[model samples]
Target: MVGVSVLEDNLKDESLILGLLDRHPIGVAAVFKRKIVFASKGLARLFGWRREEMIGRSTRIFFSDRASWEAFGERLYRLLEERDDVVLEWPLQKKDGSPIICEIITRRLRPLGDDWIVLSTIRDITAEKRSLRRLKARSSSLRLELSGALEALRREKDFLRRIIDLVPAGIGVWGPKGPVLKNELLRGLLGENIPREIPHLVGRLIRGAGRVFRFEEEIQGRHLLFTLSPIDDQNILLVVEDLTSCVKMREGLETLAQAKASHLLSQERLALMGRLLAGLTHEINTPLTFMKTNIQIFGAYVEGLRRLLEGAELAGEKRKTIDKIISEIRDITKSLEMGAERIAEIITSVKNLGRKESFNEEIDLGQALHEALILTHNKIKHHLRVFINGEPYNRQKGVPLLGVYTTGRRSLLVQMMVILINNAAEAAQRRRVKGATLEINVEDIYPRVVLTFRDNCGGVPEEELSRIFESFYSTKEEGTGLGLYILKEIVNSLEGTLEVECPKEPEGLLFRIVLSGGGGGVERIFNKTFYKGVQDGHQGIGTG
Candidate 1:
């Protein structure tokens, strides 16, 4: 019993390596003077044995021979002698004859008195190690791709900067939240010291994600225009443009256009008045001409009556012809009153034509078309055939998707109609052919009023059609080439555009005028595609 007690004392404490061995999957055995009495469930499984078959047996079965056992023993001895730890990773045999890759850690403890034994822990790390290798490779690939994209973006930024620098206007760009006020023009335009103090504030004001504000800042007596645009959550761009020169140029153009437009409007008004007067005179000619001829006859009769009355008074019988003279004077006064009423009616027509009203009011298109036709009687009377695509107002199939709403500024419409009809008349006159026809069409296209004027005097010349609406772009020998230009200006002021197309096969000019049908279409007029009037050549009449 005393020797056995001493041998047990020399063995590692059961609470230490015994616990690790209890938990370990690989077999662990302790050799005390080569007398093995230790085996766990894992050790039995490792060696293809039951616990009863392995206990009290040496670990020689786990190795091929004494040499292999001796080598493992040397490793364990070194760990025990140095009072340190040892780790080994290698393949271990499973019960089914498969190799399992594992790691083992051995540590020596001084729990036993005068003892030399090691505690070992084993873990299977083959799958875990392989997974780690794959993750590292994927991370390497992603890092490389990110680097390439970043390099390309850097090159693009440089290229963009070079392009921006060449522009005559001031330009500034901010990228995301990276930096603000990154403009080279700031120093050149605003001086170097201006951006030093609050160089970053501009970026913060319009960062990648936020409500944006526009501000105008004057630097060194020049105007700066601020605009913010969001690229995405990751990037926002603030563009600073110098609009001083641009504003000046626009103002100068606007003044000229306004002047020209006003002049043309005046000319149109005078022309309308002249037409009204001419029509009034023609219409009143029956009454006025008769009244004039009557007055001449009455004057001669009055003179003859006066001479006869003088002869009667001389003959003491003047009282006999007084009633005749009185009756003739009454006839003259009644004829003048009838002619004056006709003139009043003519004046009423002119006044109604010049009436100013909202150009945005919802109106019955048929009414407008009728009124326009009546107003253009002088111009369209002998030349053009007006065709309305849809039926009369009350007979409309329904409230059209695009309703004819009259936002009637009738004067403007009258002017455009005048110009169009006059042009058609002139075309017909030039053709000198009785069958040369002009057709004017109007339709409601849901948020747009489409008015197309086509002429059988044949289409305008291909190149000339584009210029026909340009200010001073006239083929006429008339006073100013401002008629069609002003007509387009008036149409555009009503938020409309006039498009001219001479279809290659169609043999005539088609002038299409698209106006906002009093809805969201007002913006469409500015799209350049929607309006074909008033292009690059602006004779400085910058009505736009």
Candidate 2:
């Protein structure tokens, strides 16, 4: 009673202590006199027992297979032996027969004269242990999934990019907004001025445009065929294809086609038209011939009438003069009779072009070639050198390549040849090399005429070679790009095939045309059926 001792009074009452223990998630246990005496609510729950069940039980009993926790028991006993107060951590058992690791603080209680007791407070770390285990498992799973996604994406992207890079044409993708471009392989084509921000680029792309357009555009000094398509009606995806080389090819093909077209026109307008012209002009010739003869007869009749009039006047007066006038009329009747010749010859020749006859002629491919050469002579006269080999030498070489048509349309054959020769000429010109010459070889292959046209002006680029027959593709400024395409049309129409070969050995373009010389065929009509073909338009082609 000398002073109020803090050790004797329990200001932290049972309720307060229980409340504090309940607030903590860690398991707690207490050991008294070196035995398990009490445990917090959490510890009891972890051990699958009520607090009363464990209050008097030894700490050793908490281990399911008691030997498993013997290490921790040894640690506890050593701590108790060293001092009355000890702080320790160890593994114990849970209700599920699993280990619950814990840390504990043990203190000696000396109250009411010589009675010594050990109070051990334990904190269960099982929740933390489970959390750390879950965390480790989740981390491992996430790592594996992310790694798989990354690896799959890497492989697929690499494969796609390799294919794109192999393509000669530069390919790119722009988002719906447009200035932002995403192209794995085409970035190299963009070169120096690539944008740092994709969003900014995308904003710039669709800034003003409303509709997608596919057309040629020169952007940043690069010629491109910008094919724009709005993906999902919001994003404008543009493909910028470089077409500087294509345009050049068209100009060269156009030049050759123009010449061949000129030759066909000249032939139609000149020698072939002469006979038809003679017939059309016969309207004036037949009428004029009859008119001339009648005039001559009238002159002779006038002289006789004049003489008769003079004699009648000399007979002096009435009755004699009337009779002489009547006799003059008889001679005039004879003059009119001689002028009634037929007008039949003039009508015969006028109907020549409308003849329903078809041409089944043994079409000399060589002769057509010669005519075409003569016609396009000016195209190659000054700037080109031409050589011919393997032409039919002797009469035996004529394989009788005969073509028959029940319908009269021989003119299309000429047109077909014109197309072929013109394309060759254009290819030659586009090559534009010094001392460039075109060489032709004609060989008879039984059922076909094998004509190979080659030029020393250099071959077409490998990239443009396949699309040489595509319409509207051109590398030249003034090219319509329809020359070789039309030539192909004409050849195919005549049941023939045209193939282009680029010789790696000689490094020039060699075009081989195999013609089936049987019948001018049904293909010569210039009507609706003949003109309608596959969607191929007459555009830029002629390289191949």
Leading candidate by TM-score: 1
Please report, in order, the local distance difference test score of every candidate based on alpha carbons. Answer: 0.55, 0.53
Q: Indicate which candidate wins on lDDT.
A: 1
Q: lDDT per residue, candidate 2, 5-108, as tens digits?
A: 32224222444445444433445554444355446776776667787767666676666666756776577667766676566667777656777776666555
- In candidate 2, position 297 carries an lDDT of 75
For residue 125, model 1's alpha carbon misses the true position, in angstroms, by: 70
Q: Please, what is the TM-score per model?
A: 0.33, 0.30
Whole-model lDDT, candidate 2? 0.53
RMSD of 1: 27.1
Per-candidate RMSD vs. true structure?
Answer: 27.1, 27.5
Q: What digit string (tens of lDDT, one per residue) describes model 1 on residues 260-301? A: 788889889988887787677567657666766776676677
Q: Which stretches of candidate 1 lie over 4 Å from their true place?
A: 1-349, 390-403, 504-506, 518-544
